[model samples]
Target: MRQALVVRGGWDGHQPVEATDLFLPFLKDHDFEVRVTDSPSVYADPAVMGGVDLILQCMTMSTITAEEVAGLVAAVEAGTGLAGWHGGICDAYRASADYLQLVGGQFAAHASRYAPGERSGEQADNYVPHRIEITAGDHEITRGIADFELETEQYWVLTDDYNEVLATTTTATRSWGAWQRPVTCPAVWTRQWGAGRVFVATPGHRVEVLQDLNVRTIVERGLLWAAR
Candidate 1:
C-alpha cells in the first residue's frame, strides 16, 4: 500500500481542515494509508518523510521553518510526490524561496468581481466566474478533461517556465483595477523535481470548487499522479 501524509492548517479562511477532509476517503479508497496533521513539522523528520509516497497539503499562507522546508524539498527531490491546490501549496511559505521554486508558482492575487455600481474590495467581491482551459490534452492528469468554468476565486499566479502547464485561465479587464490588459495565468501545472512529481491547481478556494466535476477529476488524478 502507498503512504500519504496530509499536512493541513494555516489561514482558517481557506478552511484547510474542511478542504483536506474532502479527499480523505478518496485517498483511502485508492489503497493509500493516509496520515493527517495540522503542522509542517513532520516534514523535518527524515524517517517519516522517507516512508511517505505522497504529501497532500492544504495549509495556505503559513510559515514553514527552514529545516522543514529543506526536508520537504529533499523528500520531493528523492521522489516523494507533492500535490495541492489554490492557496494551499502555492500561497504558502512566502518567505521561503526554495519552497516556491519547488512548487513552480506563487499566488499573487484574485481579481475582484468588479460589478459596476457595487461595493468591492472583499472576499465576496473577489468571487467571480472564470474559465479553466486545458492546454495539454496528452498529459495523463488532464487527458479527456474539457475546459470548465467556475464562479470562484480565479488566482492570478506568478509561474515559471519550468512548469508543464496543463491548464490556464485568462483574467478579464477590470474597471476597478489599474491594469487594463487581460492577464493569462496558469491554473493547473506539474513540475518534475528530481525523482519526484509536483501537481497544483489554482481553482480550489471553496469545498464546492473542489467538488466541481472537472476540478475534482483533475485534482484526484493529480494526487494519484504525484505519488512516489
Candidate 2:
C-alpha cells in the first residue's frame, strides 16, 4: 500500500487534529497506509518521506523550521503528493517565502477590502451561505462535482499562475464596509509541483462545515486527485 503521512497541529482555531481525522479513514479505505504524527520529524529525514505517497498537512498559521520546510519540498519534488485546506498550506510558515511559493498562494489579509474589479481579499463570514462556482469542469478533481452551496467562509486568496482553478465564489459587495471593489475568490484549486500534485480548499474552517455533503465530496475528491 502507498503511504500517507499526516502532520497535524497548528492554530487550534482551524481544528487541525479534528479536520485531519475526517480524512484518515477515507484514505485508509482507499488502501493508503496512513501514518499520523505530531512532530515534523518525517520532514527532516528524507528517507522517511522518500517512499511516502502523500502528505496531508493540517497545520495552519504556524511557523516551520527551515529543515522541516526543506524536507517537505524535497519530498514533493521527489513526487510525493501534497494537499491541505484553508490556511494549513497557504497561510502557514509566514516567514518562509519558499514555502508560499511551493504552495502557489499566500493568505494575505482576512478582513481587508480589495480594489475595484480586482482579485482582492474580502471579509468573509463563517455562517454565511454561498455558492461555489465550478470553473474548470473538465478537471478530474471536480469531474462529478457541480456548483454547490454551503455555509462556510468564502476564501479570498491571491492566486498564482500555477493554480488550475476548479471552482470559485463571487464576492459580494458589503455596504457595511467602505470597499468599492468586486472580487472573486478561489474556493478550490489544484496545482502541480515537480511530478507531484497539490490541492487546496478554502472553505474548511469549522469541523461541522466539513460534514456537509458537498464539502465532503469536494475534499474527498481532492484527496484522491492529489494522491500519487
Candidate 3:
C-alpha cells in the first residue's frame, strides 16, 4: 500500500486540522495508509520521509528548521509527491526561500475582507465573488472540471514560470491593490521537482470553500495525480 503523510498546524484562522480532516478519509478510500502529524520534526527523519509516497502539508505561515527543510527537499527530489491547498502549503515557511522555490509560488497578498478583530482598513476590504477558469482542460488534474464560481479570497500569488497551470482566476476589478487591468493568476498548477510531482491550489480559505463540489473534485484529482 502507498504511504501518505499529513502534517497540519499553523494559523488557527486557516483551520489546518479541520481542513486536513476533510481529506483524510478520501486519501484512505484511495487505498493509502495515511499518517498524521502536527510537528515538522517528522520531516527531519530521513527514514520516515523516505517511506512516504505523498505529503499533504497544512502548515501555514510557520518556520521550519534547516534540517527539516533539507529532509523535505530531499524526499521530494527522490520522488515523493507533495500536494496542498490555500495558505497551508504555499503560504507556509515564508522565511525559507528554498521552500518557496520548491512550491513554485508564495502568498504575496490575499484579496479578501479582514475578519472581525483583524485590522479593518481600506487595504483589507477586497473580498468578492470570482470565477475559476479551467485552463488546462486536457490535464489529468482538471480533465473533467469546468469553470466554477466562489466567494472567497482571491490569492495574489507571486509565481514562477515553471508551473504547468491547470486552472486560473482573474484579478481585473479587485479593489485591494493598485493593479488596474485584469491579471490572470494561477488557481491550480503542477510542477516537477527532481523526481517528485508538486500540486497546489490557491483556494480553500475556509472549509466551506473546500466543500464546494467542484473544488473538492479538483483537489481530489490533483492529489491522486501528484502521488507517486
Candidate 4:
C-alpha cells in the first residue's frame, strides 16, 4: 500500500483541523495507508519519511528546522509526492527559503477588500471575490474542470516560472490598495522536483473554499497526481 502522511497545524484561523478532515476519507478510500500528525518535525524521521509515498501538509506560518527541511526535500527528490492548498503549503515555513524554493511559490498577501469608508482593513477584508481560470485544462489534474469563481481569500502569491501552472486568478486594483496595476497569480500549479511532484492551490483560506466543487475536485486529483 502507498503511505500518505498529513502534517497539519499552525494558525487556527485557517481551520487546519476541519480542512484536513475533509480529505481523510478520500485518502483511505484510495487504498492509502494514512498517518496524521500535528508537526512537521516528523519529516526528519528517516524511518518514517523514507517509506512514505506522499506527504500532504497544511501547516501555515510555522517554522521548520534545517534538518527537517533537508529531509523533506530529500524525500521529494527521491520521488515522494508533496501536495497542499492555500496557506497551509504556500504560506507555510516563511523562515525557510529552502521550503519556499521546493514549493516554487510563496504567499504574498490577499487583495484587501476594504469597507465603504474604512482605511485599515479587517481580517474579513481578505475575503474578496475572485475567479480561478483553468490555464491548462489538458493537464491530468485539471482536464475536466472549468474556470470557477469564489468569494474567498484571493491570494497574491510570489511565484516562479518553474511551476506548470494549471490555473490562475487575476486581481484587480482596489481603491484601498497601494498597487496601481492589475495582477495575475497562479491559483493551481504543479512542479516537478527530481522524481517527485508538487501541487499547490492558492484557494482554501477556509473550509468552505475547499468544499467548492471545482476546488475540491482539482485538489483531490492533485493528490493522486503528486503521489509517487
Candidate 5:
C-alpha cells in the first residue's frame, strides 16, 4: 500500500482542515494509507518521508522552516507526488522562495470582480461565476473533463514556464475599472518536478464552491492523477 502524509492548518479562511477532509477519503479509496499530522514532523525526519508516496498539504500563508522546505523538496525529488488546490500548496509559504519554485506558481491576489459591488480587496469570500476552460484536452488530469463553469474566486498566479496548462479562465470584466487588454489566466495546470508530479487548481476558495458537481469532479480527478 502507498503511504500519504497530510499536513494541514495554516489559515482557517481556506478551510485547510475541512477542505483536506473532503479529499482524504478519496486517497484511502485508492488504497493509500493516509496519515494526518499538524506538527510538521515529517519535515524534521527524512526517514519519516522516505516511503511516503504522496503529500496533501493544506497549509496557507505561513512560514515553513528551512529544514522543512528541504525535506519536502527532497521527498518529492526522490519520487513522492505533491499536489494541492488553491493556496494550500502554491500560496502557502510566501517567504520561502524554494517552496514557490517547487510549486511552479504563487498566488498573487484575487483580481477582477465577480459582480458589481461584490469586489472586496480580500481573496476570501469573493465569489463569482467563472468558467474553467479545458486548455489541454489530452492531459490525463483533464482528459474527460470538458469545458465547465465554476462559481468561485478566479485566482491570479505568478507562474514559472514549466506548467502544462490544462485549463484557464478569463478575468472578470469590471465596468468601473477601465484597464483591460483581453484578460485570461490559468485556472488549472500540471507540472513535473524530478520524478514527482504537481497538480494545481485555482478555483477552490471555499468548501461550498467545490460542492458543485463539475468542480468536485475536476479536483477529484486532479488528486488521483497527481498521485504517483
Candidate 6:
C-alpha cells in the first residue's frame, strides 16, 4: 500500500484541522496508509520521510527548521509526490524560499473586502465571488471539469513559469476597484520537482469553499495524479 503523510497546523484562520478532516477519509478509501501529524518536525526525520509516497501538507504561514525543510525537499526530490491547497501548501513557510520554489508559488495577498480590524458578524469578510476556468482541460487533474464559480479568496500568487497551469481564476474589478482589472491568475497548477510532482489549488480557504462539488473533484484528482 502507498504511504501518505498529512501534516496539519498553522494559522487557525485557514482551518487546517477542519480541512484535513474533510480529506483524510478520502485518502484512506483510496488505499493509502495515511499518517497524520500536526508538527513539521516529522519532516526532519529521513527514516520517516523516506517511506512516504505522498506528502499532503496543510501548514499555512508557519516556520520550518532548516533540517525539516531539507529532509522534506530531499524526499520530494527522490520521487515522493507533494500536494495541498490554499495557503496551507502554497503560502506556507514564508521564510523558506526553498519551500516556495518547490511549490512553484507563494501567496502574495487575497482579494478581500474586510479591512484590518473590520468584522462582519462572526466572519472577517475576506471572501469574493469568482469564476474558475479550466485551462488545461486535457490534463488528468482537470480532465472533464468545466468552468465553475465560487465565493472564496481569489489568491494573488507569485508563480514561476515551471507550472503546468490546469485552471485559473480572474480578479473582478468590483472586488478591487482599479486594482482588479480582470487579472487572470492560476487557480490550479502542477509542477515537476526532481522526481516528484507538486499539485496546488488556491480556492480552499474554508471547508464550504472546498465542499463545492467541482472544487472537491479537482482537488481529489490532483492528489491522485500527483501521487507516485
**Clash count (model 2, backbone only):** 0
Cα lDDT of model 5 by residue, 98-205, tens digit: 888888889876655445476566754456567789988887777787898766677878886788888888775566545465477788888888988887888777
Native-referenced Cα lDDT, model 2 = 0.80
RMSD of each: 1.3, 4.6, 2.8, 1.4, 2.3, 2.0
Error of 5 at 50 (Å): 0.7
Candidate 4 residue lDDT tens string, 84-193? 99999999999999999999999998866774576355568677887899999999899988888899889999999999999999999977678899999999999999
CA lDDT of every candidate: 0.94, 0.80, 0.89, 0.92, 0.80, 0.88
**Candidate 5 least-lDDT 10 residues:** 111-120
TM-score (all chains, Cα) for each model: 0.97, 0.89, 0.93, 0.97, 0.90, 0.93
Tens-place lDDT per residue, model 1, 22-135, is 999999999999999999999999999999999999999899999999999999999999999999999988999999999999999887787556856567787888899999
| Model 1: residue 39 alpha-carbon error in angstroms | 0.6
Residue pairs that clash (backbone atoms under 3 angstroms), model 4: none
Residue pairs with clashing backbones, model 1 = none
Model 3 over residues 90-174: C-alpha lDDT tens digits?
Answer: 9999999989999999988765554444656643255558899998999987888889998878887989999999999987644
Clashing pairs in 6: none
Q: C-alpha displacement of 58 in model 5, angstroms?
A: 0.9
Expressed as tens digits, the lDDT of each residue in 1-228 for candidate 6 is: 899999999989889999988988999999999999999999999999999999999999899999999999999999999999999998889999888899999988766665445646444476777789999999988888899988778898889899999998887655334573667889999999999999999989888888989989988998898888
Stretches of model 5 off by over 4 angstroms after superposition: 39-41, 112-125, 176-178
The local lDDT score (0 to 100) that residue 151 gets in candidate 1 is: 96
lDDT measured at residue 168 in model 6 versus the true structure, 0 to 100? 88
Error of 5 at 4 (Å): 1.0
